[model samples]
Target: MTALDSFAPAWQIAEAVKSGTVRAEDVTRDALDRIKSLNPKVNAFTDVTAERALTEARRVDAERDAGKKLGPLAGAPIAAKNLFDIAGVTTRAGSKINRDLPAAAEDAELLKRLHAAGAVLLGALNMGEYAYDFTGENAHDGACRNPHDTTRMAGGSSSGSGSAVAAGLAPLTLGSDTNGSIRVPSSFCGVFGLKPTYGRLTRHGTFPFCDSLDHLGPLARSVRDLALSYDVMQGPDPRDHACADRPADPTFETLTDGVAGIKIARLGGFFSTDGMPEAASAVQSVAKALDTTGTVEVEGVEAGRAAAFIITNCESARLHLPNLKTRPDDFDPDTRDRFLAGALLPASWYIRALQVRHWYRENFAKLFQDVDVLLAPATPFPAPLIGQRTIEIRGEEILTRPNIGLFTQPISAIGLPVCTVPVFNSGMPIAVQVISAPWREDLCLRVAAHLESEGIVAAQPPSHL
Candidate 1:
């Protein structure tokens, strides 16, 4: 196999393995070797399940040899955020406090689905503490550095998901987005990430952040990989009350349907403000490539963002209240203070936030009447320096962490499906969010695939990879 094959998209790798052009064992070992060599530099993985991966790969090879049909993602190497429950590993969720919990008795529902589909699990990856971060800097596991430039952040709380995929250590990884975790990291690290509508995927055996707005999705080098993984993981789970009971909405079959007649519009107003030139350029590039000249304004976006923050703070704070009341020192200072403050918020404020969320969701849903997809910047900028505390956006200095999700929070607050397409500029990568109405991940993926095919957006391996 050529060196380039190691960095190929997961779908390509799977086809090779299924056709017997490459042994699943060899592919898994090569991926594990890459992780060993490159992970130290990016600090993407907190744990490496090399033995388990090789064992799974061997099973795939044996299955093929026995003339049994393999799954669509057969033999693909993938990983998950540390928040996922691996059978025998502690689900750290990027926190020191959770290290003492007993290992999960069974794998997370998504992991089990991937395994059944023939994907090998490389291991659990590093993440922001308790999913409350956007900078991808974890106090316990060290920051997940961007593969494109190790000096910059990978974007968090799905930091390792972005880094691993961009660095080619693994072709696919799963991440959870509470506000903008998946999209921010994908933008900063240069990869395709999908945040499906809230509750579209099962959350059983995964750590929680904000129950109301939390979502689980895939991050990969290609939109096809995202679609494949998403297709394999979709199903109704009684264990997760929030999981939708609707029929599976398979996206891979329709991913290449082109956006020819799809009505696409750029998000104006708040989305166009407080962002760097690169951010706007990324969105404009996608708009121009798709021949979309229409711009739509969703009013009350700022208020929606505010409501999202209030809801996230209150929900996350409540979830961690027991630990905050005891063993507070174990929590990361950045996370601890936020939780403490949230714990003190008035109940009436949370109620008001919920009301605002409903109002905003209603208004945002109405825009789909004339638009199939909405384009917006994924992050305010590509990525700040690893430890940089402040960023200048349009001449206004702002704290880097919370403001990084400026454009993303408003949309995710309403639980819309969004696909982030990486648009490269001067060797660095920023991304544009192709968003659609609730449960329309196919629309988002369709738009992203068209941009990718047109060469307007794509994932490029970092120099070292």
Candidate 2:
């Protein structure tokens, strides 16, 4: 059997498998081989389900042989961040303490959906401990290195999801974004990532981080793959109370709907890319490509970001309070310290933060009334060197971990849909955030697809890898 190119996008592989040009089992073996060889360099995966992957691939082949139609993601190999449950594999959530727990009884709802679409599960990918950090450094699982530059960070807490797709170990990967986990890594690792409106996708069977702000989405090398994976996973799940009970508004078919009628604008104020040269250039490139000259601002972002921080810290801290009391030493020191701070915050502060969140969301709604889509830098800067704690932005040194989400947090706080498109203006890839109103994921993805069509942005294959 001829092996498929490891770097092929998920859509192409699916087409080849469905057309009988290649066997799904052969593609699965090739994918497993790539993971075995490349995962060590990037530290992207925590587990590799070879037996299960082969079994799934075989099923796909059997269905094809029986003349049964396969789903859109047929024969594609993919992985999920470790925070999502995988049957017989412990959902480590990048924490040593979680290792004490038994393996999950079944896969996460999203994972099951992907499987039903004929995407094979390669395994669980690495991530920041308990999905708390933004730097992608995990004391327990080691750092998920950037595929573009092994010495640099991959961004987190969906570090492995980004790295795996960039390295071509998997064509598609699932990642959860609470603050900026999905967008940050997508920017640093040079891939297309979607953070659907909060509650757009079901989060059942996945470990919780910040319940109010957490979102699950897909990271892929191509916009169509992102759309296809996202389309299949859309629905209502009663198990995840946060999931919206609306009918699925699929974006795959509408991707070619250009930005002609959309009211696109560049973001100013807090979304400005003043300090970071790479980010500034990336945003400028995307704006110019879209012919967008209008600059708009969503007020109250500073307060919104602050509120998101407080909510994330408090909710996550509450979830792990029992573990912190019993096995504090098992927690990552960085994550533990943040959780400790959250534990000490007054209940009144949490209440106030909630109030601020409600106010900020309304502000976003009002801003979106004038614009169909907005553009901003995905990360303040590109990937930092691994273990680098502080970054100098505009002559002032700031903590790298927290500031990475400077632009992403405010949008996440409101649960608006966003699609991050990679722009290669520097050695390390930066990205532009194509944001739309809540439940308007189609608008954001359509804009991203337009950028891709114009060749203004792309997921460039990592040459260093």
Candidate 3:
């Protein structure tokens, strides 16, 4: 678990630094070297702040001798999705339009929290343009290849975060999910990703994709590390209006207590049958592995998704009204047309979506009283071919781009907490979503940790490394 130990977890890395067996400088150097050697093939990182990262690492090591009480994540190297603001780095947000903007004057609020924990900021990761798309293809930075298979996409907006962490470029990463950006990539890349409750983590200085739907969370090699990072990142930031003011529970506690006695079920209906055999079967496999007895169908899921669409489009259009008016050409082709479509949505549709949200949330709450966790597919299919627009599932060619969120959108619309547990089959990875009640991030991670411990969900490294 020293800085020299590749197999050790992040907590071990920090403890090793504290114990002097692994210096912060050495660990940071290893991360930088790994980035230099592996990033080209992965295309995960948009920027690698080698000099700044090493400089910070050296400071952390020096502070140890001064007897400063280091934070829990101290010496852990974290590369954030480009959506997070890095001082001296322009928040390009995976867009060509923002390329000319100057670097931020200070670290973003989330960055500050991570830094306070002794975590090192390595650089900015590539993402879907303005985080509006899935399927990890970046017109500007190039596609982020799936670590498990080079030919497949890594799942996106948070695509680079998934690719980077799965490839071990960094042990921890920050990713945003409006629909399935964080969950999809985490599923495809076989990493633990937590899409915290809607307002559990602050979005301050994190580029806004859809004001009502956008959420930021962590991606890590292990469930514990995900909890560790979330521990530091979850809390209110005055700057973010959506940030909740409640205190945060120790994420580690929830994961360690285990998943026994929890009313767990497989969410059927649109969540399961919509295609994603590998992903759906993965859920059943995990449930059997965990001895889950509850199995239920989620009615009105498709309707919930329609409602989510209204909110996402209406909010996204409002957020980008200026750009859609002036520099529409600068957007990624996928999102450009989508934004234009959103710009034309009727105001009444948006209002109805709001009403739907209130109703859906209440209905979802009743389900939670019967079941603690609802297992669903993170992405209906595994990582697709880089440019694929359609996927054949059960004799039907489904729209690949938007279908990625088939199971995820409805759950997100209700602002629930969920975790993606990666399932591998025939050299490919698919993940199941572990959905919990709102603000119940603890329960989601707990179930995911149970699956991980049983070896149902394993984080396998890329071959040929």
Candidate 4:
């Protein structure tokens, strides 16, 4: 690997810039060059902010030259999912309809925060249409190919966030997860992704998916990068009412505390079944590494997933009601039908779903009382072929797109923090979810970092990249 390749980790890049070992301009230019060479094959980046990135890099260099104190992510080149509003760029939430909308007045809240921490914005990455997909196939923008195997799917709606990080296009990228958007892609692309507890980060300026379930977090190659980005983005924002009013809870300080004395358990029952052998083995490997054979079952997990589906449909439909009435033709057919069905959902069903959600949350909170972290497969299996629809899981045929989030939905339903750590196999990479109670992201990161330290879980970028 070249010197530039050594900077693939955001933390390393930041430290290098901070110590005057490398200029931020050089780092930014190297990243942009990589994007130019590799993006066509991976389709990870939808936009490349070359000019803005150079400008920011030069500013960072100037600060360093003047001997000013730098931020934690100083000089890191990062990107955001296209859903985020970038100033002077039209926010296309993977749809053709939003292409004509006026450019954003300013950067999104998270982008502003990252910028304040001295992270340079590279550009916007591609995602599923309106953040409504599990596969990274965009009808308007085109499919985001997996870096591991270009013919395979990169799980979405945060498709490009995973692809970019895996391809080494950017060390850190922000993705919004309403269901498994963040985790699924991380699994498929062989990278680490954080889907922080809902409301942990402000959602102000991003395109809405499911307001109740929407969460914005980071995708990176290392546990420390995830913690660094997450710490930089945490804060209260009046713009997003859902954002927690709590002060920043930094995880970097405690990331290497180790998992000793922490009770970790594997999620059994529904999670153990209806998945390929690879998925089961991934979780088992993580469980074995943690030396925890104890199992905990979250009752009504299937029902919880069903409830999440109902809520996602209803909320997403509500957000697009006006557009659904005016330009339904502009949406991806799969997204359109789902939204239509959601719009037609009975009020009774929606209300009951909400009630069930609360009940599930209560039960999940109880589960955390005994266990500090829970382990589960991030996806039912590795990435399916790009265009293939059905997947055979233990002799049962299941539709590929919807079922990919089967394991993730139930956990995200109650808004718990989850860190998806990539687990490599002989074939493709799968991921295991390290879940913790709400607001206890520290615990999740701690466990994930421990696993990384042991070399049991690590990010393996594609050789072709």
Cand. 4 TM to true fold: 0.98
Candidate 4 lDDT tens digits, 261-370: 89999998898854478888788788899999999998888889999999999998998999999998989999999999999999899999999999989988898888
Question: Model 1 over residues 1-465: C-alpha lDDT tens digits?
Answer: 433366789898889888988888899999998899999999999999989999999999999999999999999999999999998899999999999999989999999999999999999999999999999999999999999999999999999999999999999999999999999999999999999998899999999998998999999999999999999999899888889585688999998788878889999988884447888788778888988899889878988999999999999999999999989999999999999989999999999999999998888888999898999999988889989999998898889998999888998898999999998875679999999988899999999998888888999988764
- Model 3 lDDT at residue 89: 92
Better of 3 and 4 by lDDT: 4
- lDDT string, candidate 3, 1-465, tens digits: 233645355777888788778889889888888888888988999988888898889888989989988888878889999989898899999999988889987877888998989988899998999888888899988998887887899999899999988888888899999998899999888888899888888888878888888888998888888888888887777678788575676778778788878888887666655445776577778878878756687556777899888888888888888988889888887788888788899999889888888887787788887888888778777889999999988669888888888878888887889888888864787888888888788898998898899888977887765
Clashing pairs in 3: 74-118
TM-score of each: 0.98, 0.99, 0.97, 0.98
* Clashes (N, CA, C under 3 Å) per candidate: 0, 0, 1, 0
Candidate number achieving the greatest lDDT relative to the actual structure: 2
- Give lDDT tens digits, candidate 2, residues 236-259: 998888884857999999999888
Taking all chains together, the TM-score of candidate 1 against the true structure is 0.98
Which RMSD does model 2 reach against the true structure? 0.9
Cα lDDT for residue 29, candidate 1:
90
lDDT of each: 0.92, 0.93, 0.84, 0.92
Candidates 2 and 3: which is better by TM-score?
2
- Give stretches of model 4 more than 4 Å off: 273-275
Instruction: Please give the distance, in angstroms, between residue 89's alpha carbon in candidate 2 and its true position after superposition.
Output: 0.4
